[model samples]
Target: MPNALPWLDAAPVLAACAAVAGFLRPRRGTAEVFLVGAGPGDPDLLTVAAVKALGRADVVLYDALVGPGILDLAPKSALRVFVGKRSGAHAMAQEAISALIAARAAAGKVVVRLKGGDPMMFGRAGEEIDHLKARGIPVTVIPGITAALGCAASAGVSLTRRGVAATVHFVTAHRCDAGATPDWSRLADPEGTLCVYMGKEQASAVRGGLLAGGLDPATPVLAIENGTRPDERRVSGPLSALPDLTAALGGGPALIIIGWAVAGAEASSPVSAALAG
Candidate 1:
């Protein structure tokens, strides 16, 4: 009789063990999001952290400029969504993209927002971060190569040289608010290299600003389209010829580098010679 019900005596111990296990269990409803940089236009340039994040992503939100072959790193099961915006075409609005990211993350899925170039550099990461934080979603950012660095490397041009270019300034010709523009006068530093992002359509404004700011129109300038890609094109000339150079290329992502340091590239090379002035 004593043995028949003896197992019941351990109920308290078992209950305590259950309580400990419950305490150790992971909490539910937590959100996780990764803001990852896909580099300029080279899949090989992806950082290890970026690769890992993409591999484990349950959903990936990508930009228009993300390099080819980069998305292949993600698992086949991951949902790939294009959230990029071209000059005049937007696949998804900023607010809608943010809402979608937060919604996917809230469902307890691993979310990766894959962006072109560095997330913090003109990528509108702040707006997304703010949206996610307000909804209690945790965010992690992994940096990648910016367009200026990638374009310079592919063109064999140095953005900053020992004596020629002591500093480098990164500016964007496109603004979120239409009609608003960068202060080109402040950016026309003689000793610093100027890297213009999204300046293809605004090439004339860029040239005018630098010239008016007293930057020598003869300063060496290099325009790279589809930088670091197989179809990449390079045009090098004086600042006075920037607009024409930009116009010569097909509609593609482009970066404009202006400074004496650009002279480091072989302007006589076949790819750039015809446009080199």
Candidate 2:
């Protein structure tokens, strides 16, 4: 028989090269899941490393609060999954999300679990990390600007001001139980700055709790909605007027800042002395 053509051997070589590439390729991304922080609704806030990771990602699982602009950073081929979670509306259960992350990572794809604000804060990132670790999946966290700080900065207010705010407290306005209340005694302290997250619907209850705890009804309150976003809104009034102001303004992620620092920042800082009295 005539000698096989030289190209005949090329087929085997190409198959071997493909096999090696498959084997050398990561079972996941450079890391299993890159837990990236989407930052406070701005594409400029994205770190250089985060930008690179976004380009390499095969999938991006993002949250509701994460601005739509961050999606522009991801690779065109990447699969974008929206696990929208409002204060009460959760599309995917926590457990399901964890499993989904691990499953995607295990499939030899770069997985980016993009969350708004800092992942370690009120982000519930601990649960996801624990779940991934339990399955021997690698995970990494990238910090971003948290809402409290982000809102304060964008509003040109400081969360803690020397001689004005001696302490700062971050609390959730709405908890798992609607009727449950936080420690009003501590929250009532006038010396500290209070940052209430996810309290839009319970604005009245929040104001009432603070007032009942002996906080001045006229204490200055700054309500920032959709902080750091284009439609961001800010209202300065007394704690008593927060509910009405927020209701009138309508729509956005409402964050409440209450304390002497709000008014102390300036003699006439827009804050009302409780119900505009």
Candidate 3:
């Protein structure tokens, strides 16, 4: 006849349930999609706007390069989907990823397409943007530090130094079409810094192209692996040694910096020291 559940005992259970409910509450936002840059590998490099967008994300579709620390910024209730692509293995095709984004947004969800590095730089964000725009979905973009800048800063290398590197160029070693190559002659500026992304596998090609294009073989080159992250490693040497230097780095997202500005930049480990010798 008396109350089966006492207030004190039931109070704790009810409070726990409330907390869970609050944590799992669905969020709605004005923008249907947010294209956020995760900023290399370091979570500290994430922009303020990027953080805010991630916080309010109802669904986050992230790439392989987006670290776990960055993804943890999203709400616990948000759906985190992996649509990342590595060299030979792709979790989801680009077309499928684009379609999923539109479908999620059309369902009235706040979708965040989280990319590593500045979304505009080699991130394929334009493709996603075009897809969303064609569907009339409102989207917002938040930029973050690109890998080149982050790696250069970590290595204490000034991409552009007075009387040295007058210009800077960012290029990718991998092309969408096989057997296609970038204009090496145009990129071989004596007074310019060249940063090559996704060049780990194509190190030999890069070295050969630059050499054939008449870039000074004695030019300094620095390869920073896992740049801006805790385990960051830097290897500095001549442009002729780019292939060996890159090979010593093992498997990791690396940025190859070529210019006089990176000549004397500090190397964290003996890999660079060995290469330099």
Report lDDT (CA) for all predictions: 0.87, 0.78, 0.86
lDDT of 1 by residue, 1-277 (tens): 4588755788789998887555333345557789999999889999877887887788999999998999999999999999899988999999999999999999988889999999999999999999999988889898999999999988887888898899999999999898999988778899999999999899999999889899998898888888888888877888888888788777889998999988846532354556553
Per-model TM-score versus the true fold: 0.87, 0.83, 0.88
Error of 1 at 108 (Å): 0.8
As a whole number from 0 to 100, the lDDT of residue 20 in candidate 2 is 53
Writing each residue's lDDT as its tens digit, candidate 3 over 64-147 gives 888659988999999999998889889998999999999999988889999999999998899999999998997778888999
Local distance difference test, candidate 3? 0.86
Q: Pick the candidate with the highest TM-score.
A: 3
Least accurate 10 contiguous residues by lDDT in model 2: 265-274
How do the residues 192-225 of candidate 2 rate in per-residue lDDT, one tens digit apiece?
A: 9999888778788888878888998888888777
Q: If the candidates were sorted by their TM-score against the true structure, best first, what order would they fall in?
A: 3, 1, 2
* Order of the predicted models by lDDT, top scorer first: 1, 3, 2
